[model samples]
Target: MRLSTLVYMHKNMEKMEPLLYDVIVVGGGISGLSAAARLKQFHVKSLVIEAASIMGGRMRTHQETNLELGAQWIHGGVNANSLYNYAIQKGVLNKENKIQEDSEKGIFFYTSTGRMIDLETSQKAWEIHERIVDESENYPKGGNGVQISLKSYYEKQAKEKLKELRQVAKNKTFSGEYESDLDYDEEDLKLAMDALIIQFEAYCGDTLDEAGVAVYGTSQELPGGDVPFPSGTSSVIRELEKEIDERVMNTKVTRIEWKDDSYFISTEERPEAYRAKHVILTVPLGVLQKKSITIEPPLGVAKETAIANLRPGRISKVFLHFNEPFWIPGEGDIIFLWTKKEMEQGVKSKDWTTRVSSIHELESCPNWMVMWVSGDAAVIVDSIDDEQVLKGATRILRRFTGDPGISVPDKILRHPWLADPLTLGTWSYPSIHSKHQDYYELMRAMPSPENPRLLLAGEHVHPQYWSFMHGARLSGLEQADKIIKYMGKMKPKQNGISAAK
Candidate 1:
């Protein structure tokens, strides 16, 4: 059915007795849309209620430049990722969609004082960082029954490695075999540690002190590297939207009340309430944490505790569209390294520039560059004005590149995901207080799992794939299957008619 026809049907139904849908999927994001689409495939009556004016929640694209404001890359590329495979099957993504890997682009490292580090030294530092990260995968279990943060583990390893490197350099000097020009120094050690923290924050979606070390390598990754859609990430959403014909846009569900073996979903925009035999809530974890929507007969203590334990990850991007490229063509990423003194002063000064981790050239958009700010930095950047953000970005670029004459961007684009009420934040991450079982608890159906009337579906619920688009899509399909099976077990009424009908 066409959207217009669905809208017409909804309007006409609202004027009369409320129709009890078989399933009502809340939040028209990837997860909700996927669930509704799966339900439609089984010929089940379903409706998607979205608070936003358009679909594709976090997979939003900037209409003007055709650039993705959220979820720009498909993390697993074309490997075993279900979302990537689905997009390929729908013909939305093809061979041309593959993005240039980091190795393909020239990467340069620079200190805060505008001194560029040699490639050899930078490579060595990165190698050391990678080695330590790899070792985290084998972090000893049951360490005296005391939990440790990723930060603590990283610091301990880094200190030992730095000591080893310094000892080797000292031995070489004593043997009269040391080359002053090629030797690693204290400055290099500090830069490596700084870079590691910045990169880890981006990966973990929080400061090292917050994420637990136990879940360091719990999430699985696909074989292929990250890839971006040539058009935009929303291309997948467009395809999914085609499969889902019934959706009410701009309908913000304010409350969900369970009564008489059914769910009465209330919206702030309309007087009539929506009735459904089952509901699939796909809102972000952040929204649930904020209590934006009320649930009568509140979720049990176990589920509520799980919700409180999982933290919302945040990340903000600033797209600077320049009239011309300032640096060398195809420069993949320019990483900024802060000295120990600069790091100390930056903490006291609370400078936004200090929060900038790296700037990268967009392969799809040649003239555009993107600056990544994650963790607490994302919150600050999202709250500030565009002009202030641009000023700070300009200063950082000039200082890092040692180019005093670099031109400011002609246009700057950013989306405040952290500040957006609908999202509240970007994704979900395992915090120091989080446990693996918390994910299962969060997704467990209300009342009882045997009779699941209210189902939860989102990335946060996925055990092995949380914090990815594919994870969200898979969770949606899983919930839809649960609803389908539940409906299958229902017998017809005495009149040989279904209660759902």
Candidate 2:
């Protein structure tokens, strides 16, 4: 049956019978939408309840500038990634989309003292940083019996590599290998080490000290590299929204009560309660951590423990739109390297600008530059006003580029994901106290897997793909399939028909 027809029938049936549905998904993000779409394929009566007025939770895009305000990249372009495949099939991604290569070809690295690092030295530093990152992954796969923070591991590797480089330079000088002094100084070496750490922190969406080394390489990456939607990431959400738009309701689910085989979902605005045989929760990890929704007959000790251990990571972006570009065109990215002394001073001053990872020119929108911030700085930026953020970003850009007369941005765009009640934070990260098993625990269905009443689906619950869009999409599909199989078993035996089919 067509989904529109099914939706119409369900609406009419609601008047006579109780408003019971086969499944009611809470949180209308990618995970919830995907689940609802999959259920619609099987002609299952399902409804999606979203707290926000609009769909596409974190995948928000600015209509005026066509710039993504949240969740921009389609990490892991093509390979076996379902999200990428779906975007490609839906014609949302095109040649305009750029592949994010690991090479630092067009990037310029500048020190806080207004000195740009030479291309050769910068390239060499990047190569060493990448090698160290790859090596750190071994810790999680039993390379070391004792797990440590990524910060500690990175420091150890950086020290060793720096010592080795110094020794090599000494050998070359002693042998009279024709060279004009040392290619880099001690200050330059320090900048490379510290800058790489900040870059990794931005990728993980938190400070390295808070992230566990044991979970470093647990998440798998697709082969084709990351890609961003030129039009916007929300295009993918819109595609999925088409399949289940009628089944979606804009309302906040405040409390959920499960008794026997039925579940009651209460909303903040509506007085009437919605009944369902099963509930699929796809809310963000931040929402769950905050306990924004009450789950009656509380989620057991294990699930509660998982929620407490896994932390919500903070990541925010500051977009500055310029009338004319001050820096050279085609310079892919501008990385700011802070001196140890400057970093120490900033801590005392509460300078949030020190936390910015890099400033990159948008490929699709050349006039716009994006400043990446994470960890404590992201939280600080989220709390501050836009004028303060603009001033801070301008100060950093002028200082790094040695251009004191750079004009202020005509417009600025930013989203306070950390402060936003709906999101609370950006994504999930494995804290020092978190374990790999916690993800599986989060995925476990309530009561029992054989006869499930409450199931969880979100990016945080994916064992190997946590914090990725594809992971969330896959988790939704997995839970939907579980419900279909369970319904198939529960079907009456009078006819040789299966609900799953």
Candidate 3:
């Protein structure tokens, strides 16, 4: 029978043959897969139901360039990440080809006027950034201070400490930090403001004005810097696939009805409901906020409130392929620190991506130029007409490079995570109204009266590590351990025969 037909047909589940599973994991993304992978170690039977035919969710690789459309890097040092450890143990990653960026690559910088800023100017920027981050770390609750955006806080602080910041940049020597300095000058404040705002827009997936001061740098950075995989993030996805026992692809779940200590999961692909002892609900926060999956009796107040309160980061990436390198050559660092002229024009277009954050000329692929955009700008690029997008992209590229001879890219690739209904956004971020404990509230779920059985695990739920892939991975393993421990306390059925087997 076709999936659509099965979805509409309401048959008597009692008459149908029961498809039972020990643990049924929904949404076979990194979180769900990691949960199942850990279950394998316990010799626990598991089934993964994925809506998409392909297993990897946000970790998609672009076909033409082989660049990651979603997660591009391991975001970890040599051996600290367990996900990387899994890939290495499974012979997925090539150790010799690992990539990391540093000042050794000779970082490049440019201004709205296409003029390069002195290293001192960029250093001042980093110092200002440190001040903002320090403030965020110190103030976990935004309500403690007069409620305001990170942008406002930055402006107020930058104005007060402008002279001190200038002196620090000129006098203090940062050994090898490549962060573009926050320039403070009557002549150069535009350069600094544009740079600062773009970083917030790209990183937070919202205007700097909307992002909360408390959650500015709340997401914990792992020990090691980012580890970009030339081979793509799929290698790690493939390595983890071996651990799954059974999986159903193209199965879109509509509802999860729990009654009498068992779950009845309905999907678009199957007529009969799938029975499971416990479920690992690992869908993205956006999906939950939309109520994509209808829970029988509804979740707790804390969890439900969190689903409504937290904001999902809607971001996009645009890859432009050129015939050749058009910018200045031999500059090892692929970064271009230039903001567009329209930004200084004192007009804010609905098209927020007027200033592209970083234009990268990757070492592995020199012919391709990559750019990252977040928030409304990314949405503008995705939703606008192709001609408009081309015109905007061309203007930004030409203005920054100071090369009017630069022609349009031969091909363009876009990572439209927001457009994807399943994902809905790039990641989760704390909005201005958020409480620090909101993530923990979302993480806590109950299978029954006071038991932590129907657990929630995802990067969005991890307070310290919410936006990172490593956080999602760690949350999955954590949930799996909870289930394992829960199961150990209960004896096996008298028959010792699962309904599926």
Candidate 4:
């Protein structure tokens, strides 16, 4: 609906039933649902309001494509992962559709010139990957010897590696074991750098020039490996839906007027407000940063400042389904990169196809290959139409595979989370300048002059699992626990009675 229509409803809608509750959880995403489920565990009265007709938030899957359009992976399958454990315990994971580990799959790396990097060179490429991860934790010191952009640090090191290769006339270990002759030009550096940046896009949602060099693996990976869901993440949503008795769908929370331990929740659909003694906001950090929902008696400076200071990630995916797979078979996933010339020509041609992060062959489904898009190219993706996206994608695929007879994909699917009204972006990431204190500020809600009337929860603010589904889920449990302890300090407000002084 248009903004004007929302404003009109805000001005003229009749007072619907004044839905009063002990607690109201805004957002039906995992965070909110988890909070509501935990609250139910304590036998605390609670209701959930979801803006979308369905729940699961970013965990949605495309029905036709069967592609997980959001929250596509479980980084940690068991132990340390509550959500995955829940899926296992409840048998929510589809047994017919087994999860596949992305790392264990085969991967092929191709240059812009349509030449696949040999296995030996691919091993070197992995060595580069490890070097960059190390850089994420600790960047190489310049003359001044401090941290710099991955781009700058990487280029400098690449230049040095080239000099050493030329000096020795062959690729060799520093200990003097000969490996192979370095047969590369300046273009190889560009290709590797660009591909690495694209890979970071999937994780950090920022360009290499801007991403904090050492922030990549700074957060703990849940061990094991990430697995894609063939049945989609909706199973988790369906499970949460069963637990939530009061599910308010399609209610866009516009303004929340909080005062004296009570919340008057307003929505675009109704001028009438839902009153609650406490409110839990499980909205994504992007939505909160957008200030999509106004909180009357505005949040405290710390909360506002934290919201402004923290960074929200942006990413999108392109899924191309075909009659057959002409791509090479790897044990795991495939990494495709454009040659410097190919990358340049595509940009000059205004085709963003060269921007794909990775072309992942779905092991469970052979007819499809998913391409991840991120960084500046992702921004450009929003402006182009679908036909061009498919055309550009196929053109690049044929060029890399050297298969002129390869036909166009039978269908195309793209996930533009950046343009999503509800999400506004993907997960959150700590930029080069981010601090933990800001996250703390975002987590702790403003005291209502009398009681803690509001709480915030999402993957971004998670202590251990930031930017992951498990982190978001655990955050809700933590927030619910916080509220439970908070409410323990005072008696529950009886219905139709004001708890305010």
Q: Of the candidates shown, which would achieve the greatest lDDT relative to the real structure?
A: 2
Task: In angstroms, give how far residue 241 of model 1 lies from its true place.
Answer: 0.6
lDDT for each residue of candidate 2 in 149-246, tens digit (9 for 90 to 100): 88888889988998898888889888997445777666576687877788878878787887787865677777777788767888888899987734
lDDT of each: 0.80, 0.80, 0.69, 0.70
Model with the higher TM-score, candidate 1 or 3: 1
Tens-digit lDDT track of model 1 for 113-159: 78878776777777777887877756643232245788888878888
Clashing pairs in 3: 122-181, 125-181, 125-182
Q: Which stretches of candidate 3 lie over 4 Å from their true place?
A: 1-15, 78-80, 94-101, 105-120, 130-148, 166-186, 269-272, 329-348, 385-388, 448-450, 489-501
- Using TM-score as the measure, which candidate wins? 1
TM-score per candidate? 0.91, 0.91, 0.83, 0.83
Q: Least accurate stretch of 10 residues (summed lDDT) in model 2? A: 492-501
- Model 4: which residue pairs collide? 105-331, 105-332, 106-330, 106-331, 106-332, 112-338, 112-339, 136-214
- Screening candidate 1 with a backbone cut-off below 3 angstroms (N, C-alpha, C), the clashing residue pairs are none
Q: Candidate 4 — which residues are off by over 4 angstroms?
A: 1-13, 94-106, 138-190, 214-218, 328-334, 339-351, 448-450, 489-501
Whichever of 1 and 2 has more TM-score, that candidate is 1
lDDT of 1: 0.80
lDDT of 3: 0.69
RMSD in Å for all candidates = 4.7, 4.1, 6.5, 6.7
